[model samples]
Target: MPKSWPDQLLQMLLTLAVILSTALTIFIITLPSSYSHFQSGEITEEDFTEDDRQHAGRSGYSYYHNHRDTDGKLKTECTIQIVVLGDIGRSPRMQYHALSVASHGGRVDLIGYVESEVHPDVQRSRFISVVPIKPHPKQLQASNRLLFLLVAPLKVLWQVFSLYYALGYQTKASKWMLVQNPPSIPTMAVAQFVCFFRNTRLVIDWHNFGYSILAMRLGSRHPLVTLAKWYEGLFSQDATAHFAVTNAMARVLKKEWAVEALALHDRPPNHFQPLTSIQRSTFLASLPDTAKYAANIEDGSWRLIVSSTSWTADEDFALLLDALVDYSARAAENERIPKILAIITGKGPLKQYYLNHIQHSKENGKLPNVDITTAWLSAADYASLLGSADLGISLHTSSSGVDLPMKVVDMFGTGLPVVGWSKFEAWTELVQEGKNGCGFDSAEGLTQLLQDLFGDDGQRLKILRQGALEECNRRWDDEWMPVAGQLFQLKP
Candidate 1:
């Protein structure tokens, strides 16, 4: 009854099998991975090159950029390294270029500020690598930037050497180095040296002739400005290829600076999708009750005027303020005019100063007929708000007289038509009258255009918004591919 001899033998065999399986599982689970093996003293890390271990035991960026091949070899496939001295957040141009490369399954080695991480969309690729620059002597100090410009060459030379040594330690023979200009005088000089040492071809993306940009903050005839211009023109000769953001910029580079350059305009990212009404409502909700119609834009009763600014001097936020006040005063002359909610979005050098001034103006009964709010939103939030707005207003009238406004490009990407102040030479090429939107030369003209654009019936507003969305569908990566494709061929 207790089980015969044969049954007892079978039960014993089953217990033995269970014991063996348990032991085997423990052995496999405890086996060392690359990192663990290296740590445990079993694997000699000296045998594997530094680049091979580059991705090991690192956080967000380096983790994705690991160089382990299937055979456990440390391998790096990144041919071109994009270098920007400042934060990628500070330069959407650099960010977009790196992201575009990642999307195409091409590996990227990006060197920039610590605050920047690879944008989420590009994280899909395991090939994206980022090397954060070491902290500067006094970067957080507000006066550091002014000090930087004065000691520009020295500060930038230090950075170049620092990154060169760091890069030399990690990887070998990076084929090409694409450098962003302005901080141009220093960047071009530093990049040329780095490329020479690394044996990488140097390419410059001239966002603007650096001297023109420097003249905006520093005086046009200041020694530093003159020195910067001369040096920029001098060092630019070393660049194998130059990319100008506008045709006018390319012309200036060729005729004035005596450097051959090509025009390759900027474009929005692939993920800047058309915003739906629901998404717009969600983004508007993130704003305080004072903005975007007190979070009650559902009825579309109050006209929502949205503008994005970088808070730079050249952008001239004062122009938008003047136009807003002008329109408000005109509306007050007639009570029949519609109520308005003006949303100005962005953060920058003058952001806090302007925000306080705006609040003070409203409290003093200065902006009585209109409510204006500044909403500093994430990139995603910004795109949503741009798409939701009745109209966008661009204050950028080209500080350099050549470089086009990326803010306007972003607005157009959402198909949110904009009424922009004209730099005639630059803005005229982008903002078409009664097509994408209108352009203005004065605050009074902008005020008049705003009223005409958002008329009580919203008829013309609908047409402009639709046109914006259609234009938004134009080339992003494809537009830049021919230029980027050239990088693959430019060896030595």
Candidate 2:
């Protein structure tokens, strides 16, 4: 049956009306208080506590109340306490950045959740202090583990709802509340009003857009996106400053939330002294089985190493695998087996998946020649491995921008020529193609680049031995220190 034009038009209008009504309903029902007068830039601990308690009954307020230090008076009058509600595993760059700020004479306190054990070296790093917070049990489960997955979101939602209501009910204040990878909704809900409070500077570090991750995970649009959008709006309207690791993220922040955010280029801290050849070899000798995979590669094969946590989906190592297969096939004609290796370090939900995928490929003859290894390595061990690699790789998805991968920085510090995708703005700026390293837009381009470098031994050796080290020293300077110092103003 053919529908008439008027009938089709009427149906379309009805659908549009329903969507508009739903959106309006959400706005009126879920919107938190947009307090305009609380614009002062200084606050006391008591005031922050009082506000949270007062707002305990509100629908969307959540508060992370830090108890007052009773042992001694606040020694540093202008000490900045930056509370980051995220995992330590995913925040090495932040940790180093905080250390850099502290090195430049800013008193910095980082509050976050860490695993049961802390690495000794990480504990000894100067310029930063870590305060441990309790992590939810569900966070320990693997990403593919379904038992925790079914109930985790619900628990997170309830926690967020409770926290939001509590914070809104009391009006507890802070000088600055930077929610870096908060676990759930209520934290963001509370953060909205914290921005509204006169003395509070609300900063949301958009690490990986949680809403987008959730969308990809569930294969559907979750209601949390709507809530996140509302908080994003609140931050946009009232936040004193907004920052993202990459320009692409900044673009999303501006387009979706109408917030103008600065792209803060993350650089490595200068504390790590250049390891001598002997010291570097000694450090590599102490690494675990998986961490030392790079050492097994023959001298002639152009080895490419990727050092990152297991869970980062944005790395796109699959492209690297495909490219390696292609490289091997081409090299075979010249009586050569392309001796390329990929070493994946760190642990996360995707650990097993990555392992299984790689193992299956090798077993099924898809990637017969390429050697793939995965491991959970400490920070020091990972750094040592980076020093051993000939070339580093940092490939991110479209959503990423000029985020200088900490691995890239470590590789540069070790004088390894980097071969990676040209998408990340920071990489493009730091790595001059065929000088210190090479960048490409496609797998074929990268393969060809690798072939060229492999064939030209002299040029490749120059980059690996000297050019990259010079680039690292030149880039890791004091220009980015101000961003860390700015955290001090948030202290009460």
Candidate 3:
């Protein structure tokens, strides 16, 4: 204890070095492997060993078994689960589609972070059931303060670990899984690879071009854009099939991946049927604001209907308003200014943006006659309103050249001539310049197109209102059910 200063200093330095070396050795021994089985695209008996099985069970693998079929062939039929993961908002289309597929004998399970109580109709639907998984309380609150202080770093770490776990589980579980709008591409890609490795099939339903939208909304350099692109690549390469909502989307997928993607256009619920003229009038009459707006239209004035899930820069609602103003100006000089009215339905972050834009336009004398109203309506009621309208409007900016707005399909279904931007390849293919609908390059172009339609009622009347409906029936029929049936590959 009473040693010289030199001896004491040397002894302390040696002890510190030994401690550091031991800690480094332990870290290396305990670290998990970063080389993912899914990334490598391989599966082996070791993947299904006791250790792997335990890992899979912990990561939400719900079913497992080993057996042989009557043919003495070693075959396996694990539960094929389709997981629809996203925010369950007011629109129930996702729920409806899932239930319909399940009712037709497909195996589907909806897994979502439920923020509100499940709708009664949704609960009673044919899908096995809706399962609620709560996000971490902190993560649920996506505030600026929290994002910078904590969420971002944690998110990156979570993505890395979650992907590692999901890939292993997917390999051991069912051979097929449908993931709808998964939050993380790394996880989704790993899961998909695992399925592929096990002779499983994956179908990626591209409901919207999320990456392009995000890139437009936030700068292209945003981390989310890179992540989305990575996932898109995985979906493009590994998926057995790809489904897009619009022909525009189909073209985009084909261009990007050189794969022939299937376009599964959205259909009205199976129960939806066209209403009679009298029925349509009665439905519109029931809406109090509809009556008020309808009465504002003077005789010989054009009444227009503009509706969407939400009015956003993407929808180009501003362009629609501008065109309406231009049309009114032209008509005013000739005593033909149509009493223009707009009905906005649905909610989104851009709700206030649209409201302010409309208010500013009216104050600036651009849309003095236009009236904007918002409300919630059932699908049938919405359809009835569109059917009673003189014209229907839909639009998108240049970035959305490949997006086929479902509203166009709805307009076509209702026999309403649609006037909107024409960048979509599908629109150009399906909509004749002045036949079923007309596309425009700009607000002014759209206005001129509208003027032509209003001036010649006879010609407008002759254009096939039923053209869109016929196209829908021809292209997106019950044929998908057979492709879905192939997933089972069961003997009859």
Candidate 4:
């Protein structure tokens, strides 16, 4: 079968051509496919309402007219159907949103979980309904960290189904959804699916990215945190409009998730009203040690500085202690006879540790000029006590740049100007140096600032106090109304 040289060479070339064609075909078949950044989370145009194309500005939550009269004319209903999901009884922030909607006569189904029940007095509503849910047992057990992470999303998904049943998916009016994020697990993606299916609008209120929070609990390198960070960023893009706590977080929303975000400032609760002398005295009398402080208010011998905290690792509480000691030493060196008592409020895991340290300092006579005491007060009592303070000390720096501690807002509500311990960007936004309050980088610097404020008969301190009062005049309802109307397309 030995052929001529020309024929055999031609056949070999033909075989080589066939092999290359097959290889090229295989390569083309295995190539990665392009993804559409249409922000649809796997849903199609058919999933959306017919009017979605006409009203893309409506927080991406527009729907076609489904309501018809007896003559077949389309009816536009005034009902703003909304679903708010969070642990409202426990979280003051969530309570603010739910109460606002309910108080305004919006149809809201407020869904959350609680161990017991919040008293009916506090949970009263006509249009807003409460949907209590039970979290999976594993969600509470942190000993099995990996197991907890594995079950959390499943548990949340089950909760979403519970929400569907609770709402009954029976309405046809244009809808809106507001969900709090900490887990950030099923919130955005599941909301997208629900909104598409039910013909509603979606709004995500970003307190902080849940992954950044998880990074604080478990190191940033943990597999779950890494996955959460990636997936959350990916899915969060599906929302119509995002409301972030700070401008820095708003930038994060736009850059990381390509989301349209507006920075919504948190205002102080409206319940913190100015108290008259008699009312103030009655409130102070209810507290245990506050009466002694109240009696000496006329003397001007002792200055009361109040500091509130959740006592988490994010706060550098040691700085406050050091500053107190340093100020006392400086005052004694000058023979000024310093008298300062710090009212540290709130409790957390680190409370015992700091309490012991303060006790040791007292017993050892390490700090002579400054005294410290703890108070755990009710909401009304707490605000009243803050109003009585000469100054406020804030040690909260966000673990992430996104969150501004509510403690700062609470202090400002009482007209108590504060010295912020950390230099986070949000602090700079809220605090005007030497104006409403000042900021310091170190313990010594803060100690010096304290001396400057409390000295000279506290002339500068009074100015700062007035500034705090004037600057934070906007209450939660005032700030929330316009923003709510803008988002939901309604008048305040």
Best by lDDT: 1
If scored against the real structure, what TM-score would every candidate get?
A: 0.78, 0.69, 0.69, 0.72
Residue pairs of candidate 4 with colliding backbone atoms? none
lDDT (tens digit, per residue) of candidate 2 on 303-357: 5455564465756766776677777777766544345666777666556766777
* lDDT score for candidate 2 against the true structure: 0.56
Per-residue lDDT over 230-265 for candidate 1, one digit per residue giving the tens place of the 0 to 100 score: 999998998888888888888888887788887778
Candidate 4 per-residue lDDT over residues 225-258, each given as its tens digit: 8888888888777777778777887887788878
lDDT (Cα atoms) of all candidates against the true structure: 0.69, 0.56, 0.56, 0.67
What TM-score quantifies how close candidate 4 is to the native fold?
A: 0.72
lDDT against true structure, model 4: 0.67
- Backbone clash total for model 4 is 0
TM-score of 1: 0.78
**Can you list the residue pairs that collide in candidate 3?**
302-338
lDDT of 3 at 163: 42
* Model 3 ranges with Cα > 4 A deviation: 1-80, 89-93, 113-122, 133-175, 181-187, 190-201, 218-228, 246-255, 258-260, 293-302, 398-400, 461-466, 472-479, 485-492
